[model samples]
Target chain A: MRVAFCFDLDGTLTEEEILPQIAKHVDLYEEIELLTKITMRGLITFSKSFKLRVRLLSTIPIPTVKQTVNTILVNRPLQEFVRNNKSDCFIVTGNLDVWVDEFISREYGCAYFSSRAKVEGDKLIDIEKILDKQEAIHTLRNSYDLIVAVGDGMNDCSMLEQADIGIAFGGVHEPVSTLINIADYVCYDGLALAVLLKSLKQKYGREN
Target chain B: MAGKIDTVIICAAGLGSRLGLDMPKCLVEIGGHPLIYYLLNVLYDVPNIRMVVGFKEDIVMDCVRKIRKDVVFVRNPAYTTTTNSYSLYLGSHDLQVPFLNIDGDMYISRDNYEKFVDKIVPGEDLIGVTLSYTEDAVNVLLDSENRAIGFSREKISNYEWTGIAYLANIKIRKEGLYIYQELEAYLPIQTEEISCFEIDTPQDLEYLSNKMGHL
Candidate 1:
């Protein structure tokens, strides 16, 4: 059976939230953290909060954002798992593609879907496009027999709801209640998440 | 088919209302740590571990992740209306291999529990028997060979069922009988006596806490 393993970028893969780490670069950590918390709490819509967060963070040059994201640590076991199973892994994140592109490419070398950023030679201008996570799952539906999606944010609700198996991961932070209500499994650690994914992959044809 | 055991199924789904703690019994604190903490430590060497959680499952998972993160958790949403036997059934349904079943609310000595685990031989069923101590227990009736012949609640016996067993997946029946009662059809199974304490009431907790303090 063909299976696709989809993961959220910020808190699910990275040990810390990426945007907030980038916010630290421009002394706007508090603002970005507040936005992230409300977004995760479902107090604000993901699109609205994400757009505003990007506007606030766009002040930092593109190079600075990439550098900050590069310094952020990822969950080691998860990274290694994705690196080993590159053919079956996909990263689905709402973060700007311009910011995380280089870091994700170098670290994981896996296919990714991210919100787009309109840039003019090293300077951010406007949000070109916002990624709807469900679209990534829908796109992979034809090729895979099962889509297992993992995330820890309020924005992940749609993608998780659409996937064959939704995992509410809380390794770095608590998964929002809305996501938890729909998750097939709620995992709280990185190694545990990787192990679950491996098991699912192994048991796909036999007893899934 | 004797071989090394690969998996352990820990039943931690009960409300444990008898203790009146308003929390999952496994989360009950004994020596500054939850009871499940000690059990996880005892099974540290086992390769694959699964926990069945229901009452306050979020809290239990959070607590366990801090200690051991690799345990595969299975949710038993019917915990309120069911017993540990049902929890064991849910945990073992997908398992095609032999596994160790253990109660969540116990404080077992590491050395003694390890010895019991060492005696495990896959494809062969074994029941764990501990010294009789609790006010209420399912006593194990042993033959001259020290093998378990039957289980009784009212009969006086020197050893009580420890709620720990090593058996293949075929022994698990879907009936909601208590774990020991479920094993009645498979009686005359091998028995392993280990040093352990099960917390069922306030008295049991206090007694074991003091006993562990002196140990």
Candidate 2:
């Protein structure tokens, strides 16, 4: 089956976001807010904000994040979706390298595009945009016969609108109405997306 | 109320150190995914499940968390220092009504679970539901009244244990609560007029899985 499955990292596959996980360790709430405003005003790319956030949170302790993320990630249903369709899947997120590299990206063996983090001395630093998500989705729209994009949040709206099948995920944060309006389906559960894609592949997978 | 059984405490605290997995036994693979996933899926079908975790507790919780985020997780802080009954007692309070107890690593079939619970008379004080036992099972003896007499030894009894199910009444619920206050408390309680079923080791797990396949 020539299928492409793309997803939002934090809420789609995980119950919580990486930033909140970092926040649990580092008292970077004030600095994180500053980065959010900077990104909102287009002052810096998402990559920069991610880098700054991780760099600030680096002192919090790597083992804590590693152990916590491993605990948070291990048997997630969202990852099951990706695993069930490993060959055709990809992860598109604004999350950092430490999580994707350590937790999911390799385990599922799927291509993932996300903001890159700066790390030194076992400490994670700023994020630099490694893959512009919108651009990636827009490019993929023409590359595949059918595209399924699953994500939660306003930022995911652009990619969802560009895909043949758009699934608004509520596993993380709820998507904005505008984003939902553009999606073909909105499901509160991540497994529903997996089921939908599985059926889609079964029905049309063998068609020439 | 979140329904009759608002919560369920699955005793997954066993350190299956024999399996030699980096993660816990619950997180080991039976069907490409973790073994705990199978139990959790059938449990979620019940609509109310609170997982009881201890050994590699974080791993077990993390594994279950991805599948159902709203599930209640209670840790048996003294898991390594206790037994299955003790683990259940540690997190028993969250289950207010007659609760269904399950082993975290066993393979479960939804139809069997439904069939067993359906036999329970709605408001009756059914202490426990004991099924016939098979060889390689921890067997229970049934009296004339069908109350569990004691565990069998000389021969495999007429009934074999179906480790896969339970329908505990409130009295047993209270007993379960008090059973672990002292370590030896479990011994006499084990000899009480209690209903018994078996779910302790991998031999039973393989027997049930081979019998039931994946469900």
Candidate 3:
């Protein structure tokens, strides 16, 4: 049976959140950061907080947003591992595809499922729809025997709960309590996470 | 990023008095092979292997050398006066990276060994445990977080601490004390439950010998 390895983008894959970086360009970093914290802590709905943050940064130029995202560092070891096992890996995020597609999809060459954005010719506009992470895992379940989800925030709880194995990552931010409560394993470093993924693949990858 | 654990310290300095053997405990034959044979075979992937030998060190070294020639031997000359704690301290007193610490007397299945290795998460210290317990087993008590809160010989909890642990660092202020006592100070220590058996008595040897007969 084939296994699907799903990763949360914002704080799990990238060292920092991209929205806050974009907010830096528009002088709204503090406000967006506060909202991000609230959303990550499960104090507010991610869908609501995400829409508000995007609206606050809607006036920023597309080029500046691109440059801001380009400066964000990818978790190098995790990226390398995902690159090596691209056949079964995915990036599942609530971030807009327009903002993250260039780097995550184009450069890293990994498949992704993210919130759709409504853009008007080089200028930011609004979020068209938010991707339900749990639904994403359910869709992948049709083809994969085991789905392992890795994330570190409240928004990732559903995805983690729905997967065969859930790993709460603390490499960037300490995993939120809600996510930790549901995770089968909590990993604090990339090597440990990589080792776990490899072991799972080795154990269940050949069973079916 | 974390690195793979490459070093393993095996404490094999005990005398097999309970088994009524005159040789080192690690050299006792279990199913036509020494106890170290099964241990070394299970740990072959680790790059660095260190063993603490005493109580007929020459014979133990000669026997172990036939299995794996690359092992570095650390001698505990005061094997009569010291316990396994001293042997463990002598084996891993100066190391920076995390390494696995395993007792030499354990007889574990290959599946259980692989499961134990898979349960290891880098950056978190772990103590391998089993749900099955005996009256003489050193049982462990865990909090909600699965951290070892207490350890005792009595049936204090449902989990028994197998003599297997992964230490994140080798720097210790109390070298003479038992490893679990030294580690208890660093609370919230993680635990992993795996199938394992320790060959400590004549009955244990008989039980394992009979168990292996079915295979």
Specify the highest-lDDT model's number.
1
Candidate 2 regions with alpha-carbon error over 4 angstroms: A28-52, A61-64, A73-75, A138-143, B1-215
Query: Between which residue pairs do clashes occur in model 1?
Result: none
Ranking by lDDT: 1, 3, 2
TM-score of the second chain in each model? Answer: 0.94, 0.70, 0.93
Chain A fold similarity by TM-score, each prediction = 0.97, 0.78, 0.97
Candidate 1: tens digits of C-alpha lDDT, residues B82-152? 89999998777645567889988977887887778777765788889988886678999899998999899
Task: Go through the candidates in order and give each one's C-alpha lDDT.
Answer: 0.85, 0.58, 0.80
Find the 10 residues in a row with the least total lDDT in model 1 chain A: A199-208
Q: Candidate 3, chain A: TM-score?
A: 0.97
- Tens digits of per-residue lDDT, candidate 3, A72-183, equal 9888778887988887899999998888888786446889999998989988787899998998899899999889999999999999989987877877777796776676
TM-score of each: 0.81, 0.44, 0.55
Model 3: chain B TM-score relative to the native chain B: 0.93
Residues B68-181, candidate 2: write the lDDT tens digits.
765545455566666666666544532335566666765555555555555555444322334445444445555666644454434545554443333344323324432222
Q: Considering only N, C-alpha and C atoms within 3 Å, which residue pairs clash in candidate 3?
A: none
